[model samples]
Target: MVFLLFSAATSFAKTPLQPILPLLEAMPSDLHVTVPYLLSFVMADPLKMAMVSIENNLSPPETLQKLSESLTSLLPLLSQLADIIPRDALLWKLKLLKSGAAYANSRLHAVQAEVLFLASGKDNLLPSGEEADRLFKGLKNCRVRYFKENGHTLLLEDGVNLLSVIKGANMYRRGRQRDFVTDYLPPTLSEFKKTFDEDHKLFHLALSPVMMSTLTNGKIVRGLAGVPDQGPVLFVGYHALMGIELSPLYEEFLREKNTIVRGMAHPMLFGSKYETSRQESSRLDTVSMYGGLPVTPINMYRLFERNQYVLLYPGGAREALHRKVCLMSPYLY
Candidate 1:
């Protein structure tokens, strides 16, 4: 009797009996042949049975329903271990192991917009592209591509290729947009003509010996010079030696020409006690009567409205006295 029992146990050991048997049983002849033939029954008999008993005793549920739920959860994990151990031969010796399912779940949720999976040939941990593909399977809108002849630190090794890939992806996304081109030819031509006319007037003024000599030496020469006498004209020039040199020249030019030139002086000039005195004030009032507009913030806006010739220094003071030798370029606003 003991010999028969031992033989039955050996057969059962070689085949791993299902923890939760199927609700529908197999036919008697089918079960007898298949169950005994399984390799797991031959190799994992007494030890497996002992382990199962111990597991059940330690992890006993309060209710039958809880036991069923526990078995359901464990079966998938056991199957995963069986699959993993054979493929990854190094893990075959491990009898019990924990999975990274929780970590994997966390990674899946953390993915927001996109993911870049970079794999290298030399990396021992993830040598095959299959591992990276498996991990990214759960991710939505994720792509995986391999870098040939590159190792674990692929980014460092293949920086140019990586950059090319990123640029290509960006170009692909941006190219999907619709492009509209409208004709700006008429407006552009009109603006060009107006600018050309203004440039021609400036070119003529620049040739004047008084204007040229005044600018060359550090003397100031401010005046109104434009067509349509009282129309809106901008008198652009260079200034040197603060307001001392410029003020007298501006007064003289306006008085001689009998044309209003609104000189836009810096606030610093007017803020001075000497320049803002009663005597100077009287002189400025006299100049104002003979067509000189002393540009204050209050009257500057109004002067422009009346189509008056306005004098302006684009550089203010910084560019005017930048160095002892002046550069030949106009200081643009």
Candidate 2:
């Protein structure tokens, strides 16, 4: 098992080892541990909790009755496990969890390597959040991502998208170093559908914007017919009122022009503060997936060099939130 795990870690082309809850489930399935603990740890009242989860859109409709039925089914299997496994074996496993971290703490500082610590806020089984902070302080190159509502088994839970987390952290790269432009991943068809149909569905319907373009002769035309049918185009516009204009602008180009606007976005959108409280899916993720790069001179240059359509907001927050001055002034700031 150790060899296989090591091989799996090394096979990924120098990706660092991620040790998450090592030996977490190695306990022998004795009735004392499995029967009572498993039942209470997850579902004290399976049917009731299931109903609550369903009502909150956390689980499917069928989960209510089905979960209760599943719990009943677990009894016989747990009984079988109690008979098969020794009680002392289970007790020793329990002992390990109590002392495992303390044992590892002294040795951890000796190992100098990059670490990504994922802390679960509601982890019932362990003090994950506190441990993560401790590890972050001790380790040289450690970064932490906290999942406040998640448990120890967050990977198997619903709405936990790992790729999105990695992307939001700006940790996606092909080589040793990072390159924002070359490393950016465009939104897939599924992502596009989700963003339009699910995320911004209401906004798209409410606005139903009318797009128009003008020619060099000052002749106006309906739709994007007058717009260039090529790349390297820069669309500069006012960021009116909390950037509500962004959605339609991006969507219309996608729907009609078949273009992904590489908007030079502010760092605030991609910062850690946003990720700490974000749950399940986020519009910020959508922004990044749709080619929203950090507002920097190099990023803009890169987009133009690649012959990609670019979008920029010169005024930024000053224009979006405090628009009265921008409205009165003939010249844009």
Candidate 3:
């Protein structure tokens, strides 16, 4: 791991690493270290004390049941980790994040590698910002894949097709081997029909999604009627309410215009740095296959140069929170 140093904002007490005895006893051998590592931020000292107090207040049987319930929910979130990251080590890693100035774009530009940056949209620790964009821009050969809805632990998230993503990346380097499968491929009409039918069924069963269109001259036209049926178009829009608009909008475009909007995303969708676990590796692969590329200006420029319909949300995570200012802002580029 690369170490970057910057002046500390506040001197953290030089506390000793916490013991792993409790974690080992509480979890399985395979998950002995991984769970605590991922949950370090989540189960910070304060929160752990709170949980202990809550448990202590309960009867023995009740406490056992509560622990069981909590662990069941927490285990899944802890899935991607490969090993138990030592507390001191994890803390040191976190310090690097706190010292963000250490990983400047100028420094990143010095490295020569095919970097695939996967940024999380809901990363609480290192939230999305201009810094990611700057680093992406500075890189020589880099691709970005962003997960618009996921948190920092994308590798542990559901529905990520990791194999397809790797295949796609290799294709990028090897002149587009068309025979390989990738998550990026638009669903075939039949595939879409099956999935859409199910979604349509659910949509009608719950809150029915209504699609509106415009009238041209005298006749009603599809939403994408004016868009060229050829190459290279960009669609800019707001990310509203956890980007609820994304699915409906994509479905609408495919239904009406037969267009697939390639989205620019944060890099976390690609995977985690500590992809020690097979499960985590699998999840990142799924994200790549789904055509989720990292948010980068260069990637967008190239897509436009190649004539693809790209989807861009100027207001990213900020707008998704339903903040009025974020939603009402004129531009967020």
**What are the Cα lDDT values of the candidates?**
0.37, 0.60, 0.49
> Model 1 TM-score?
0.24
Q: What is model 1's C-alpha RMSD?
A: 33.3
Model 1 spans > 4 angstroms off? 1-227, 243-252, 272-299, 320-333
Specify the highest-lDDT model's number: 2
Q: Report lDDT (Cα) of residue 248, candidate 2.
A: 79
In terms of TM-score, which candidate is stronger, 2 or 3? Answer: 2
Off by over 4 Å in 2: 1-40, 43-100, 107-116, 132-144, 214-223, 268-285, 323-333
Q: Which candidate ranks first by TM-score, i.e. highest?
A: 2
For model 3, give the 10-residue run with minimal summed lDDT.
Answer: 1-10
Worst 10 residues of 1 by lDDT: 1-10
What are the clash counts of all predictions, listed in order?
9, 0, 25
Q: What is the TM-score of each candidate against the true structure?
A: 0.24, 0.64, 0.39
Error of 3 at 326 (Å): 14
Q: For candidate 3, write residues 95-172 as lDDT tens digits.
A: 664365454423665766555555545544444323345445665554545555555444544433333344444333
Q: How big is the positional error of residue 208 in model 1, measured in Å on the Cα after superposition?
A: 12
- Candidate scoring better on lDDT of 1 and 2: 2
> How much is 325 displaced in model 1, in angstroms?
17
Q: How far is candidate 3 from the true structure (C-alpha RMSD, Å)?
A: 13.9
